[model samples]
Target: MRNKIITVCTAAVMLVMTASCGADKNMKKGEKFLAIGEYYEAAIQFKKAYGKTPPKERDKRGQRAAKLARCYDRMNSHQKAIAAYRNVIRYKQDTPETHAALARLLLKNGNYKEAAREFQTVLDTLKGNRLAENGLESALTAQRKKEEGSRYIVRKMDVFNSRRADFSPMFYGDEYDRLYFTSTRNEAEGDELSGITGTKNGDIFYSEKDDKGKWGKPQTIESGLNTEFDEGACCFTPDQREMYLTQCTSDPAYPRYATIVTSNRTDAAWSKATKLDITRDTLSSYAHPAISPDGEWLYFTSDMPGGKGGLDIWRVRITGAGLGGVENLGEPVNTAGDEMFPTFRPNGDLYFSSNGHPGMGGLDIFIASPDKKTGKFVLEHPGYPLNSQGDDFGMTFEGPHNRGFFSSNRGDGRGWDHIYSFEKPEIIQTVKGWVYEMEGYELPAAQVYMVGNDGTNLKLSVKGDGSFTQVVNPGTDYIMLATCKGFLNHKEEISIRQTDESEEHVLQFPLASIRVPVLIDNIFYDFDKYTLKPESATALDELVKLLEENPNVTIELSAHCDYRGSEAYNKKLSQKRAETVVEYLIAHGIAKDRLTPVGYGKEKPKTIRKKLTEAYPWLKEGDVLTEDFIKQLDKDKQEMCNQLNRRTEFIVLRTTYGMFDEKGNLKNPPKPAKEENKHDEDEIFDIFIE
Candidate 1:
């Protein structure tokens, strides 16, 4: 009887408390919900409060109006936020913060020019305000970038999308015909609605193209990875054998923390997931896993302590057995705001989304590439349509090209992310090369390393026949070095001019043996004049490269006359010609001490080499050329002999150019090689790199 009386008394007290709470209504409820990150619900309550308060209570009405505007901004309702903010200024006196807040929201909604005005107003009132100053700069930058247009044509993937939130798309399988993504629609497998997102728990879904290359309706992935919790933001190992995804579990006692889990693929089915072992004890939340192209590192987003702020990008090394310690990506990449959804191109460029960095208001995508010399990652904004004021993230690529899909919530007032396809049309540029012996077979196992001014350093692989192709962006200078165990290292410098037309560059590294003369092919001097023609620059520059490659070995730059001019005249002319070649070499950076100019003239007649004999079967390898001897041959043979006789060649006089000094440091280091002797016919190899 006492317990029943107490229960009735307690119930009456609760009823009274509820009545008192409802009486105060609007402002209190809105503030409470806003504190808990419930922007949608808070906006509704604040709007009600703004309507109820009379204009006579100017301070109270303006405060409610400002809160309502903030709520709308948080919910990504741009138009409503603008209207409410305008009401705040009209009802009560304006302040610098309110104008700044409105300006920030306007910039996020892509109203760049209007945002600039609001930011200017804030600056005018409150001088030297960092936020206002930065806001104006960002608004102006975004305005200019948008006006310039963008290469990407972004459009909603309507066929694969539902009315609910769908995002974080990734390619599945080697064929890449299958696409997997996350969704929180009503049809999701979870039995409970999430209090955090106010929707069904996130689940993984997949869609595939039909025979006609059109996507069908997406189907839920029933691999048990999705439970009565959130599961999304997945990545695959380079081998595609293991899948890593984010899982957020709920706890009634405390707020939930997300973790990364790995699932192995067994016969096309995903096995049960196991939580990844991270290094830090302070990582409160872990999600959004991205594996490096080499599969050696796993990068993820974390809200762990010691971060820049909010959330930051961190990585752990993936060894053959297990994982390694966690390390932050640090500065330029992570900011005081949230940085999430990290992805990688096959070439090691990192793409991630952040609100910490200056952007179009919300989370914008930025690319970070490592500096080859400094090893520091430099951040770059892809700009415009690739990023926006709404939450844009989860970028995935088709390959190295400028076409891919990313997620955005720009058009949604409720901030629901959806998949959108973007592509930039461009002319493909490439560099192709072959490594072979000067007079022998191809050097199939030669190692070729390349470093570019744009911070690209990679060890290039070759095909069975010693051919290699690498895709290069226009306007970048690249130095490529090819080395074989038995031969000297060959260096070439390639300068790719920016052009809209698709093109290819070819470089041939004809490595010479310790003993032999290498002909500088396609080299020519003017008829009766020793001047080098513009057409001969290509060949002469290649000769300079050969000298630089075999630095320690001094070379004799010999010029031979065709035995048509007087012996005395030929000797003087050939001597001048050899000196001209040597001067050109010195001018191009080859040390003068490494070269000896020799004019063979008519003194040493031409002898057919194996390559020449093979091309002209009637000719023998030891056939000597003199004026009388050439007259005995056929007309075609005489012209060919004369052509071969009037040539420039380099014979190795020594093998060591001072590779290292007594202290083991290089005395005369080779400069980064510049490419030469390129011909128009080499453009045929352009398609190989593509």
Candidate 2:
């Protein structure tokens, strides 16, 4: 009986010791976990410590509460973090950092009035605090925007989402029938739980539409692409022949390193993955692959050195040549916080997510406008429904329009991202172009090439009626060029704007035939001299650009003189003038061999081309500007004839200049004359005089 009493007393003593050490021991453990960035485990220990501390122990209780608040914030539990921070303030242990942090959390939780009050409290204590000032302004602005409401219609993509994370939706295929996305659902191919999210590893899944136009259940993609490790944030090449994705390989000792991998698509199956050789640095992470709309640039998020901060958006050339060096998108796009998930609209406007820039809270989606003059990106929040206090990112558009799917953790307290569809109905801008002959008929075989200031370049094939249509984005400037085998190029400038309210724009290209002498207007030399005048430079510069575009053609740039000078003197002067034009072409990077200077002094007089003849049928072929002819015409007609006679023109010497093979034969033989276009003698004529 005495031994049993002693044992009971010992047990009671041990229990008392454990209780006495409870709060301090848990606090120490929490500190260790937080130091290692294991926030989920740290939060649990911190909460336990905070619960055990008594209300009278103000210093210890405040310490535990502050730590717990920080842990919750790190774990993405902003609401809980806010409550714990308030507890810290109640216990009189709030510091400037704590007040600022609480204010940010309030802003993120959409408590604008409370957030502004908290920021003001900090500002009152800590004078000249830029962060507090900015926080106050941001909170007030966000409140006003929230009151204004949003124009976007946002809806949860229920059919494609799961209880787990589902994000980064990519639309593919010619008909946009297939939808590919990354998910962490239980059925994902991986059996191992992720150390980061405590769920199954990410895998690529795709959904297809049936005859009813409803998306079917998503199926795991092929094994070659989806693996046991984290694989996600995929993008396809312009031709859909290749795919690039982010693959994070895990390590037990070190942090997981996210690397980009490429897989070729062939025979309706993907090949084994190969790591994209971006850089030799293995310590940094690269993820969230985004191929530019043109497919020439591969943009991704990276934490590599030489960045502005934590994770900056970077790009590299991924054309046929090897991958180029990574370039960081600096400044406003990147701050001391993370900037990630970069995607582009067809118009080259960049959409990305950032926590650094001021917004509602967490990661907010922003549209970055490219400033051509500064070579920097100016940022603007997408606002409200599209951007919330939660982590909103990984946006993909349904082609070039405004309706698209994006991933967000908004409204879900657990920080699990899910896909949402957003649409803003507006008039779709389009460009319809016509490439027809300047005078006679439409050139069915002509092709139109469009180049835009937004980095859009495409070759548009014309229909049987020499018409082509292309969808264009608003606020873009485009130069469209039309070209045919036997015709000189024609160019038209087009500008599309949103504020104009005009839905459609029409552009016309009037192509001129190359078989006849094509006049180069506005080209005039100084009186009795071969030197080109300043006014003539614009026309000559255009000729230089034309030569650069049509590299396969050799041309004779000939100058003609009026019948005022002697034949010998006129010939020499004209030859010098032609040589001067040729010299300008060569100075502007045109090949010297492609140009031939000729002088047709008084030998080749003006003959009305089809355009001129149609406007003035009285001017006939083989007409010359002799003294007798000058006396027979009226004053205006005589001046017109003289002006036409003194001109410069380009004659196509050979169409096969650079098109010949090693054996001096045309690589592409010319089509039959009838197949090209029927030449009518009544319509086609040559004018020359001596």
Candidate 3:
């Protein structure tokens, strides 16, 4: 009987010790998992421990719930995490961290009113809690803003419900019709898990819009490009020939680094992925690649050292050789808060998401432009209808259209992520066309001005291809004018109907040839002087108007000397006269290239010398008679002779026409024959001789 009792007691002691050892082992395992960011597994282990413990020792239920809340929050289940946090506070006394987390989650879920109250509760209960106090104020501010309506709307919401994390979205192709995103779904090829989060794995997946404008089912991007570790945050060149994406390596022995990998799209399949030499630090993580339209500037996000905060937006110059280091965006674009996911529009506007700026909650998409004065990107929060009180980012416009795609987890009831399309308001019609001289030459640097019926003039410079485009509101009659210095002005008028989709008007302006003499409309000069008088300013003004009207026309200003003077003296005098005309044009802001001076020196007279002599029989050929000879003759004779020679004229030397071949050479139109001058019976020319 004694031996039996001893054996039973010893067995009971051993069992108790084993149970304690197992309990301690589980606690350590849970702690280890949580330390490595495997919150889900830690929560599971904690739950098991809570379940197996006796009711007296089951106070760990609240702790397990807290752990579960953390896991759910990491998974972006803000609502669920909020509920779990509530349970934590209800069962275990309210903690500052719990209250703060709840308030944050509530704000992110767009429960601003409730969030404000929860934050106030934290301030009232927790002493010396600055973070909670600030959070409460932020929540209250958001509530006030919410009364004005959500800064952004959640149009369409869908979720990708993989067992692992899904993140980092990018648009590709000209139409932005296809979307590429990273997912840790079961379709990933590698069995290896992330060392940081211990997630199942990651691979790139593509979803494309179909004919009906609905997203087709997502499929993994084909072989050699997507590995088992992580492939995400992709950006494509504007031409869609090359793709840059982020790849995460899982080996802990090697420090964690997110490398930029590239692939070429050919034959409808991506080529084998090649690693880029963009990784500078072994511990730093670089991801979320965005290439500029010209593919010269590359923007990305990195958690490298010397960041303003957690993850900052960085950029590197890219060329055919490789990336040229990296630079942080700094300040307003990147704060102590994380900023990532950058994209550029076709118009050179930059759109990015950030939690650093003052926002509703979580990450909100913001826009930045280089400040004219500061020479830095001035970040501005996209207010009302573009940013909600949730994580709103990863936006890309659909081609050149205002329709865009972005990801949000705002009022969407589904716990999974879905792609949403944003349609911009249509308020104007865009006009596009080519501007050319009469001779088909692509006129670069031509000024295009649009005059509204109300006389509002908007000026735009023509591209190298002589193409100009502008956006004008409907219900406006626009007079479009193209002008290049020295070229004949071209004008067209269009009345845009409200129902017009887009206006495509091709305008061909025939510039007068440079060598063709054009009569100076109102220029009046003294009989033999090259100096422009005060009265000549009016005529010079008219010339200025003509030059302004024809920006691309290059002209030669020539002066003729009368047949009486020696050829050499006449040439010198004519050159001075032409130079005077050129000075007048230049003073009126006409570019020098538009004006060339030449002294015809009676060589190319409008009237034959014999005809002039026949009209007025000069007494002697070698007679160097001055103004006295003109006075000796009748006023009519001298005036007629003077009018024939003392004149300044313009001839277009070069006319630029739009629409050139690939070589960019000027194309001249066939010349028309000179028309016989018809003397109108009503036209009269009165000549006055002194």
Candidate 4:
């Protein structure tokens, strides 16, 4: 099957002449050029031969068309190859190989339906055809893989692409500020064009970032590093003192086979490269070198003797200045189909492109993570748009981040590989909380004890504003306790939410102050009755927890009423309501002696707070809601003041309860239990206006 290269070309429609001599001569010349890998010249000869042959000679015309198509395929002229293959089929000269090549080209051009048919046609006869089977799977996967696309933001690196194929991006040096890649640009050393890509043979080129962080124009590496032959697909040692790369030397007498070579870095320039004696098998190709992060293994692609499949990833141990025996990575990393372009993230993840695995299309990239139990790599496909229905390979990461550049021919009609930058933004999650007195302002001196299910135990201090923000991991459960001197701890439990965007979770830590009475908001009761409403359970339960958090503290539950009611009636109602709250607290595990109920009636008025002024701009902070003060306001404002006055609250009586006895000796803790009490006062109560 044809590899990734030329696709589209301008059509040359010429009427075939009933010529004999010129057609035969041109066809033979085309065959010679095609055999020697002069695809550009081969295509020229075949096209002329196809045109000169008589139209009635369909077989001869088809042969020439198929030959031209093969050249176009190798040159990355995808569209032209597709058109030429159709001609070969229309003329009744199509073979299984021809159909397989057409299937690949059609798939790259997004004609999956037609490509599938072609693949099936070839696979029906050639049951062991790996290319056809892989192509069929790619066709189906390409249609369904998009919904599972990753969060990676991929963009073409236009500065790195050229008219010809430019691929295999590699980061250079410790700083990762320089980028090296293989390009077949016209400026490359070779005067002759590559029959493979219809451009000059590939050369190593590099670009460095300027002070402004923009990559400067790419420049060819000096002389000894590059030669007339194809030199690219390179990797550097951790120290960058040694370079390993692929080099393909051309010889018309035989087929060109790629071999790995090494070059030493002398000063700022690379010394002349020498072929690595990897194995005795001269018929095989060795290319695409990658150095492990630890610099202990040299991973490269080879069709060597012991490979599991076509072009499997193999590794040779780096022993000082020499290499050890090679080992195939083996299944499922190496499939029956071609697997190439193996690279690594700084974090030991092996990334390679393969058509053997179920993929979107062409060479879709896969990540091989080291399985903890077996230490063997387990494959994972990072779904679209990091991969697509075209040849996608050559991944290079910038350090440990989930971001970097890779090469792909996706969306390019010519099937030329171009560099693309991709990044999956980090899921930044943080928990922001404010620790403050329940009835007062922020507790700036408060300390928060934080614990998480993910082994995170930390003591965080609040800022001057009593707010603490800490970075948290996603999908992890966490609990925080905000504590300060003279204050009962406030416990908050949360989980970092699962979402696509970075998230900030807000928590409120309203610590119960041991000195002042803290208003218990959200406490509700039946209108005109002291009977507690069902909704009052939540507030009462929280109070129970607060008392439990400070086991040594005793509290007095005080209830008050607005001045609209009679003094005696209000007092009786407030007293009954306070008694109800105490009962609820006692039922929820607080000691009966630790809680005392009191009724202040209309004698105690509420004070306006800064928060109240926000909703009612007419009111000011620190304004006492006495009967006289509430009456002068608007009807809504007056009710709001009264609503604030009719409240239930608690004040800490002593922090030594159940801790020290009359003898001043520390006593054992007391077990909390409920006790029965009778209160037959009137059932009058206030609304839960707040």
Candidate 5:
């Protein structure tokens, strides 16, 4: 009986020893895989070792769990990482680093409250740890952001997504009907799996919209662009002539580094991609390229030195040669945590993904729009549905529309980024303006300076068609000044009222010609009489405002006759009309000596203008409306020509009106003040610190 009991004890002891040895072997294998950056394999090995570790050996089990959590974190298995980290905490292995890592994972998993607690714990232990402080701030903000939903409607595009990761979508071609993205599906071009991701190497896959505007099956770009090495995030020049792509070349013995490469467009496929020499800094990783609206700069993400964060958005001047002068975006745009995947809208708004900024969770998308007043970029977040507790990034717009596609990992616990379409049903409150000469065609060379009560100071560049459209906020007042080289300046002030729906207001700027007579339309008088009509009050008021706007200019206010009445009667009536205008002007604050009333009665005939020729195809420009010419015209044409001849016009007599003193000698005029929009020193300091 004694021998039997001893034998059982010996057998149990041997079994225990065997399990311990296996766990140790598994741990060593996991450490080896981790050293080589094979996170997926390392995770599997670590999980096995953790399962084999005995519950009685809490220290050993805790260490194994910690390793497993780290591996899962690297692999982006957020849910799994959270579970493993909880196990580490349960086993009393709660180091400051472990708490920080656990907090980050919880934050990524949408457990904002838990993340905040853990982040606070980390901050308490590791005093002044910027990463922990930032995480805490993010966690607290995530709770509020999650509660406040956004206007953006987001939905997964399953047809364009795969079981594995798919992300970084770009709209291509003229119609933006073609979509190109990176994927790790089974059908990816490469057979070899990434050491870092444990999935097939990323390849650039694309889909084209059919005649019905429906997306077709995604196809891999199987040219030299896709190799066994990972290739992803890509952008094109505005002209779409050249493509910039992110490439990660792996070495079995060392860690992989991401670098940007350029490919020239060919007739069929992209030419072989060549590495871009953005400085000789091979040690830093550069990825996620975006071209500015004017193609003057190349914006990308990098982990180089002098950045305000772990990964910062950097830009380099794009010259005829290679890139010149690399600069960090700095401060508010870059944070202690990672900021990656930069994209742009046609209006020069920069969109990017960040973990450092206060957000809903994970890598939330943010916009950095330039403040026209301060010349600084202001950050904004599109809350809720557009952003989630999962990694959301890689946004692409269809031209200037707000509706577009982005990548998110929301419902996928595996953290595999999938393409999701997002659209903010536009509440487009805008101001569309036309700046032109008073009686001539549009002035395309004009420039408009705008100032809004909401601290908006924008220098608007007019389109070739002499039009400008700008989005505006509700209940704001905007003042705009239109200026052209050969025309007098015109100013308009508008008040945008708050409304329940979108509205577009139109403003017309008719700058008076400095070299020619500007006919004032809408001025009315009694039939064959000199008495001013009540409707003429509005038109005369407008002229009064114009005169006040250009205070230094003195004008010749003239009235003409229609050549129907006798020359003496027409001259006498025209003289009375001119004097009436001068009297109204003097009553409205005009200096008496500044006005020179002229009566041109049937002597100077009117010539057809471009606008008139367009309105009446029978009439051509340079055609004069003389008495004989009017006699040959039809009844309607004769009346129109007669109306054109009986008009009131103003031409600048002198621009230096008030520059002369009573002595007739020229007095020095106060230098025209230069108006510029600049931020005060305190505002700049706040921006830098922020």
Candidate 6:
């Protein structure tokens, strides 16, 4: 009986050893697979091993759970991964690794607040975990930003709902009280799946608001323009007679390409769509169409070869033939990230969506100001509430209304995407006007100077066509001045009242021609000396006004000598006089940088005795010229000859403001100031005759 018992014990021990070896082998294989990124297979092996483990091996169960969580995370089953990570935390209290993993998962799921708390807990439990500490700080910061964003009052509009997906919304409202948008709802007439995402196709839909401000049910727009592939993103001309939209093509020969199409509305029904010839095969894709307020320009997004990255906003002039060649919007607006869905408000401000820049998540809407000079767009992200860690895009403004619609996937009870109407806070009134010559010509490129009530000077450059626009707060009076070289500077008061017109105020400035030399209105000299005296302060002030008025105008200061002094001494004195005027101007605010002083001495006299004699027979004179004789000369000749001796004058050399309008009409002509006859002969010798 003893021998038989020993045999049974030996067999039992052998069986136990065999089972243990098999379990060890399986565990090793699972770990190897996990290290090689075979998470699905590894999880299976780990599950099997755990099932075979003895009940007393509780640590093995926890290990298996942790491994399974990693596998889920690798497989992108974030919810399941999070649950597994929570189980690891339950079994291993205060463990830094487990807390870190859980916190990261929470953050990925957009649960920033919870993630922040978890990270804080880990930091409190352990020290010297720099990575965790940094992560905690980031999570807390994101939580604060998210909270702030949620405070804005957003009006929800369930404009479209699809069993599959509805996205990329574009809004257009009309005087007739109707709103239009793009959707991929089930009721849309198109193919089942999108060629790009292999999802539901997209179409255009519109809704109307009643007199009570309640939105009506949305319905698909039926038109030959919308194709079976994809058609969405519509913008209307200011007149609302024409509409611009994007049409996608799915053929592999034309993968990811979209063409801009236009249709006219007549009798409340849209005409057949016509494809614009602007699209080219070399362009990978083109989408998101927008038309300028005047309908002179068409803007869209494309992934052409020269784009900054995945997609970039481009614009082209709309002409009779078709859209001109596309031009890329570079830098600040177009980043390495995808930029799409461009819209233009009636105010001429640009709005678009981009993922190329840092934001909460996905794509966020951004605003850009078209820099007419550089032909570039300056982009600015609407931070916080206007943006979120979710895709917020497709924004449009209703005419003159501060309230508008935008699409967002933000957590506002809508599953993934929804349309929301938001009221933009009160914006300050802006003053925009054009400076032109009195000849009814528009000066497209001129420099504008705005003097605030506090005397602060703001300078702005006009467009190439001499048009100037500026933004100013209401309740402030501004001194608007436009200036250019060889033209009279313009000054006017622009009073912005609470009731100022929202449309651009058209102010046509008529500048007189600066054919004659303008007197240094405030310049003063010592009794008989050419030196600039302290009293020149007044003249310096006037010069400063001129300079501030014409920020881009450059002048040449010329000093002349009277017949009283010897030629050499007069030359020296005149040179000194020119330098003195330059110094005064520089002291008063005129950039010394722009003044070039020269002395004509006795050369190039304003009035020649022979010319004066011929013009006016009364000037039958000798070497000494009479005041009346000088005055009788031509204005240019009289002004030139008057200073044949001692005087200073200015001639415009360069200008920031252009002289002509689009039609080549002179702009900003100088007005002649009234003249006085006081010093008689001395005055004539000082200013006119020598």
- Among these predicted structures, which one has the highest TM-score? 5
- After TM-score superposition, the amount by which residue 143's alpha carbon in candidate 3 deviates from its true location, in angstroms, is 3.7
Over 424-451, each residue of candidate 5 has an lDDT whose tens digit, in order, gives 8876677888998887888878877777
Candidate 4: tens digits of C-alpha lDDT, residues 1-690: 133222222122222233567888888888888777778888898898887877778888898899999999887788899999999999999999899889888877778899899999999999977767877988877878877677889999989888888999999855578999999998898698776666789999999998788998899987688988899999887656788999999887677789999999887789999999887889999999999876779898988777776789999888866888788999889987789999988667999999778777678899999986687888898998998888899999875567889999888877778999999887656788999877568887787877778866666656556876677878799878787888887777898767887777889999887776689999998997899999988888888877776777888999999998799999999999999999888888889999999999998787777756777788788888888898888898788888889899888898877767888877754334435332211111000000
Q: Point out the worst 10-residue segment of candidate 3 by lDDT.
A: 681-690
Off by over 4 Å in 2: 1-13, 19-71, 87-95, 121-132, 372-375, 431-448, 451-470, 473-690
1-690 in candidate 3: lDDT tens per residue?
Answer: 999999999997787667656755766776776665555566666556645544444345567567768777776767768877887776674577687788888878877778878877777887656556655666777656656753244466354335454555677654456778777677777775553445566788888888887877778876688766777778887556788888876553334467788899888899878887665476677778888754678898888888887788888888678777677878767876678888886555678887656568777788887675676787766665667777877777654455667766666553444456676654435677676543235666576666676544555555545765556667778776666665566566788767735444445543433444655645655666677777878867766766665555678898877667788988988898789889888987988877899988867645332323544575343343345555677877776655655667787766552324568864543335445444221211100000
Worst 10 residues of 1 by lDDT: 681-690
Best by lDDT: 5
lDDT of 6 by residue, 1-690 (tens): 999999999998787677667767778877876654456566667667656666455566567668877776654456777887776665563267678777766765678788778877788877755546645654656556666664345666665545434455545443336777767666777656552333456777788777897878888776675667678888876556788888875553322457777899887788878877776564566678888765678888887788887789988888777667678878787876578988876556888887556455446777887775674667765667777656677877655444578887666322346677766665545565666653224555456666666433565555434555555656677767676654767666777667534544566565533554443434557755676778777756656666666666778888866555577877877787889888878877777768899877766444333434655454443434445556667877665555543556777777644565887776655445446522232221221110
For model 5, the run of ten residues with the poorest summed lDDT: 681-690
Task: State model 4's lDDT.
Answer: 0.83
lDDT of 2 by residue, 240-300 (tens): 7788899987665455688999998888888878998799998888899888765679999
| lDDT to native, each model | 0.78, 0.79, 0.67, 0.83, 0.86, 0.65
Which has the better TM-score: candidate 3, or candidate 5? 5
lDDT of 1 at 341: 98
The TM-scores of all predictions, comma-separated, are 0.57, 0.62, 0.57, 0.59, 0.63, 0.47
Local accuracy of candidate 1 as per-residue lDDT tens digits, 503-610:
778899888765666777777778898888889898787767666666667888888888887889989998899999899989999889888999988888777666
Query: What ordering of candidates by lDDT runs from best to worst?
Result: 5, 4, 2, 1, 3, 6
Error of 2 at 203 (Å): 2.1
